[model samples]
Target chain A: MARTADVDDLVARARKGEPRAVARLITLIENASPQLREVMAALNPLAGRARVIGLTGAPGVGKSTSTNALVRAFRRQDLRVGVLAVDPSSPFTGGALLGDRVRMQDHASDAGVFIRSMASRGHLGGLAWAAPQAIRVLDAAGCDVVLVETVGVGQAEVEIASLADSTIVLVSPGMGDSIQAAKAGILEIADVFVVNKADRDGAQQTVRDLRNMIALAAPEGWKPPIVPTVAVKDEGVADVVQKLDEHLAWMEDSGELNRRRRARARDEIEAIAVTALRERMGDLHGHQRLDVLAEKVLDGSCDPYAAADELVEGLTESG
Target chain B: MARTADVDDLVARARKGEPRAVARLITLIENASPQLREVMAALNPLAGRARVIGLTGAPGVGKSTSTNALVRAFRRQDLRVGVLAVDPSSPFTGGALLGDRVRMQDHASDAGVFIRSMASRGHLGGLAWAAPQAIRVLDAAGCDVVLVETVGVGQAEVEIASLADSTIVLVSPGMGDSIQAAKAGILEIADVFVVNKADRDGAQQTVRDLRNMIALAAPEGWKPPIVPTVAVKDEGVADVVQKLDEHLAWMEDSGELNRRRRARARDEIEAIAVTALRERMGDLHGHQRLDVLAEKVLDGSCDPYAAADELVEGLTESG
Candidate 1:
């Protein structure tokens, strides 16, 4: 647990854009420190201003290169940027890949840019559970834009859409990337589509396939546009940024931004409440009540549904 | 909602191995019916007897064919087998892939075998959340063996491991299947590894790789055996079953089966309780308490953590 004065000093430094302060806050959140409630309390006044953007694609896609290009573009616009890269790989295998970090070396010395990598750690909800709190930390630290990059697989991509104001789903030529994207359900969450490695053969065909798929679906309030970019060479990077800007403007004008923020807040609250309840239940691990209920279920005296209801009622009454 | 008498009648018929009664009970669970508690109560005594087996592999890894083979083998042993195929694909895309159901047509006329496909329908925990109750239904319906098959992708595979007494991870040659399996964390959950396309060029190599990977891992209580099979021709299918039986024997002898069941029961109880709390919170929508707390966090008057605490306190008190 951190002391009250210590938390206050860290929050103040974080608000001043001290990189070390920002990093410490995130580490505390990751470790689930006892003083997290206090840290968030201190920083809440300065949060909720940064524009969060999410980038997702398959493992071999040029997500890192495109993210680097996007960072450079945002920096050129004189906006401070924060990057959170979430790796969905197993924790036993270790953290985010080294190549993803090395590719962003160009922004390493830029004081206006901050980059952090997060591993799944075998968490139940993949990146969704931890990324939102980190976003709050960066948002309070005064980053004008935050880029959340995740591998577009499983629940990680779905969670990214909920956390970000804009989501960009990237695909490259070949590798069944388009079909994988559709099967993973990224097509529904993508606010902007970026066909990376545009110089590769069949890039145009991939773009056409995506366009055809999007056309088949009934129109939503906004149509996602496909932008092609050779991220390695930074070709057409500006076009991707332009589309992002357009999407953000539309979100603002349509009041979708407020709605999204409200939903995000609600999700965060629900996650926290559920986590709290789980902790409380876990505390009763060896206690007689839960054990008795479980025994009843095992012995056929009661069903799991009935046992669960009784447990919930017990916890609420005891609390 | 269903009448108490109707639910009791359905449970009685299902316990007698009536397919329609079993299907109706599963449908009620899927729809989260009001009578679920009563139905579970009636069925609890008949469960905890069946041997649950989980089979998972990539989308094109011959899971359906292998599952079909395994069901045939079980039937030859005079065992009643129930198959639950879970599809993680989108529901609007349609129900379970017709090809999967078609491939299992060999068992369509078998009175001792039941095959059912479950589409994900955008559940929060993928197939895991619903599959457990469905397994209970099958177990109570007098099945000697229940085979749970799922595409070895996403969180569904992970959850399947927790539900089944034994988990078999399947792989075939080419298509980067081995690498995908490693990346998906199935390597850790596999109680038995099956190389399904044994005639392929790299089948032996795949087995060797899995064996080497298992050897590298610090030995747990059990060492998973690698079995080779060509499911389409029913070649080596008996070897797979032999390994499954050995694993089951080991689990029973070591008392691991009971421990796993207890943990599964705990997980179910927690999931249900959390879901109940979420519904309560959702019902609070448009209520002043939640809205006020969210507003406080959004306006920086309160942090999300504090707001969550307040919300939980309010909900518990009101309830």
Candidate 2:
């Protein structure tokens, strides 16, 4: 009862906009704590309130700088903001992520702004799998807008798009050409494209390239808008915000918002189920059955698929 | 019986170093055909013969060029070689990968050389999950050496390591500091470090920085050798090959090879089992049970954990 009361208390404080409680809850999620089930149960009803906007780009594309500028801009409008800086490349939550946390000290004193850096290093399914849960904690904690800032390298950009209501893909001049961006797979996921560091050389060309690619791709619904911004100077961020609002409105009117959220919920549920099963499977491995099968596989006595069948059957029978 | 004979004929041809048969078997793997179970069972006995070498680095770090040079080196000794250019970032098998294949035309005419490109875009567990089986195909087909070249951005580098007997982490001058490499989680995984593009500026600094980081990391067992190379020019490639052989010899002498192989087998079996369960889980979702549970969670009537529990229960009962 005391532990249950503690989870209830934590959720209550988080709902009241206490940053420490919000931080504690996210830490719980990050650590994959035993009490997570109770905490999620307590917080689930209070979630689904915040608008999640994901900002993603390759490293050195000014993702964090852009996020910092966007946070300041949102604070100007008096909106409560939560920033989840997810680094999928790092296996642990330290080093460079801590540096980002330090750089974000500009918002440290603002009670309306909560910033957290998560590293996906040791996580089973990586940070993308755990990020939806972190987002829920931030959402339940009364943030009006949650900015999920992730390094949009390769698969991570796609995963972030799935988590956010509106995804902003940042590209810098000299990073690569439009074909390179296409190869990186960022072209398909951008709801809003920010040509960050617009003051740099070839910024205009970057914008042109994006426009040409957008025309070529010609997505079925809700064509993505490109916004140019020198984020450090705070130039054109308001337009970025305005475009986000427009995208959100379009999504709402077009029923895309509802559909996206439904898909998110479905993914979240499946990820949770798979994780639970994976943990169970880990236990099965500990029982030496997997090792026995692995030995057989190594010796070529059985194929992996056949060995897998035996393991799955054993799991089902045990269950 | 004809289908079985067809599979038998294919395996027999592949065992005789027939390129088309090897290519067909890999195609079957990439497509995840139903006959894979039979193919794997047949291949399993013939695998565990090749020395698997994984080469990974950030894009533009000359992973493919290095792989190409190394393949040429391996072929000089009259060793049958298999090259798997795995693009975890790309979802499809064409475009850039095909371009790489074209660049590797030097090996196209060689009957002893088999080269294939795999994109992890639509793969269930990504290419890393599928790569082991593909490696087995090459291994069974009688490759004395199998080189896996993957872009080492984030988690893909780690996944490639699990599938490799010797993992070579490539870095280029001006790519970043050793700290950046460390942040990328490459420091811990490198068995041999290749300072690629050694003709470029800051090449020595890159090597020095890596030395510093490796000194600080101070990994137990084998110390990774840093080889400087301009892979395009085929410079220092022989040293890389020598290092690979040394690492392989060290592994065998120290029993690390057996341990690594056993671990690989364990991971492969678990991945297969997980994939099978995940596919079944997909089937469960099609029954509207997951959608219904997702809806309940969306409406705040239930949390994901409870819904996952219920789904797991249902799955077990149905099984």
Candidate 3:
């Protein structure tokens, strides 16, 4: 009950846009603290206001620079923004992405911006589940727009992109990035495509390739636009922001926003339920029981499915 | 009982090195068929004999060529080899990697060799869980060795590599691939490093970079050897195979093989159990219940964790 009061206080501070309170709330999420449920319950009513946008691409695609430009653009309109730079590769390197975070120092002293780098450690479902909670923190903290940037084209990146209201897939010219993006099946998730470093020699070809691909795989609604930019120089960024606004308007008008949000909430609730079930099973049976089952499966006394069935039965009974 | 007899007959045929039966069993795995448990139970006794080797790299790093070269090298010694070319990118393009799979036309006629390309669709745990069961099928089919080649540096690739007895990370010269690999945090999982395209420019630098990174990390026990190979020409392919054999020896002598296998089995069992629990919950509640709960969460009537708790209670009571 004391902790409940503290969580309420924290939520109040965060809702008033106190940077420390927001940071502390996210830390609770990252650590998966026991106070998390209390924190989420407190923050829930204040969220659902921030528009979430996701950016993803390969490592050297100027994602950080692009993110910085977007942050500046959003701030120019006096919009409060939050950035979550999620690195799926660096499990051991907590805060190892300080260099990238340093690249975002333009917003360090600005009260309107909150930039945090997160390492996707081996949590329950990795970034898929943790990210939405972090986004919720930013939303509850009164960020008008929250930007999520994920490195590389891993499944986690895809999942995070799906969670966003608009996902911008960044590609640099001359790297065959469009083809790589296509091969990685990232093209489908792109609500907006940005060809950064557009002044490069192969920029036309990159745009052409993307245009052709977009034409071929055009979905029923919301044909993703390709915007070329030199993000490092802060060129064409306002156009990206405009496109984002247009996409958000379209999403809201077409009822896609509500569907997407509901889908996201459904996934969030399911991930939590599954994680809780797993933890409960782990607490009840421990590794010793699973180890025995695994040994039996290995020795041909049982199949994995059969072992799993027995374990689930035990979990249900215990519950 | 009749289905069990059929599963036993199929397993017997697979054990006799019948390619059709092996393909059938793997098809069951790909589809997650109901007969999978019976097949796995029948196959488990015959597995644990074959060495499962994992090769991973960026797309143009010549992984398929390297796999082909290794298959040739292994077949020269009359060793039965099974290759699972897993393409995580081509989930919608089922069997769309026919071109790459066709490149192994050299071994297509050889009954001693079994090659299959797998697409890691949206399975419960994706490739991490499906791959092991597929490998078990190959292992039970009297294969002396299994080679799993995964594309890109995604988390799934890293996970699949960890499941191998010896994981070979291939990088080409002049691509900054070593740096990319290091950034992907895959350097720690390498049991053997193959510098493919060794004759290309900057080959020495790539090798040097990997050496330095390895030296810096310096994992204890079984230092991974860097092997240079021009796999397309089959030059140094035999050396790579030799290094693999040596790594296998080290793993066995160090008891690392058993440890890795047990760990893999444990993960497999846990994935299955979690999937089973999720399915049971889904069956009991259906999407309507989840949608209603999600609506409640979205409307601020409830938070995700609280909704999850209620769902779990429902699952437990229903069970």
Top model by TM-score, which number?
A: 2
**Residue A304 in candidate 1, Cα distance off native in Å:** 0.8
Chain B, TM-score, each prediction? 0.93, 0.96, 0.95
lDDT of 1 by residue, A129-201 (tens): 5678889889889899999998666566777898999999998898485555666787888999999998999
Q: What fraction of the true Cα-Cα contacts (under 8 Å, chains A to B) does candidate 3 also have?
A: 0.67
Q: Over the stretch A1-319, how does candidate 3's per-residue lDDT look in tens digits?
A: 3477788898899999998898788778777788988889988988999999999987678998999999999999999999988877666544444654576568777999988877666677677678889999999999999999888665765776667999999988876655566767777789999999999889889999999999888778899999999999999999999999999999999999999999899889888998887787666656677778878877878888888888888888888
> lDDT by residue for model 2 over B143-166, one digit each (tens)?
999998886788788888888999
TM-score for candidate 2, residues paired by index: 0.97
Candidate 3, superposed: residue stretches over 4 Å from native: A1-9, A93-97, A177-179, B1-9, B93-95, B177-180
The RMSD of every model to the true structure, in order and in angstroms, is 2.7, 1.9, 2.4
Candidate 3: residue B247 Cα off by (Å): 2.2
Q: How many backbone clashes does candidate 3 have?
A: 0
By DockQ, the candidates rank as: 2, 3, 1
What overall lDDT, based on C-alpha atoms, would model 2 receive against the true structure? 0.85
Off by over 4 Å in 1: A97-104, A121-126, A177-181, A285-288, B97-100, B124-128, B174-183, B285-288
Candidate 1, residues B2-53, lDDT tens digits: the string is 6888888999999988888987887776666668778888889889889999
Model 3, residue B191: displacement in angstroms?
1.2
Clash pairs, candidate 3, are none
Name the better of 2 and 3 by TM-score: 2
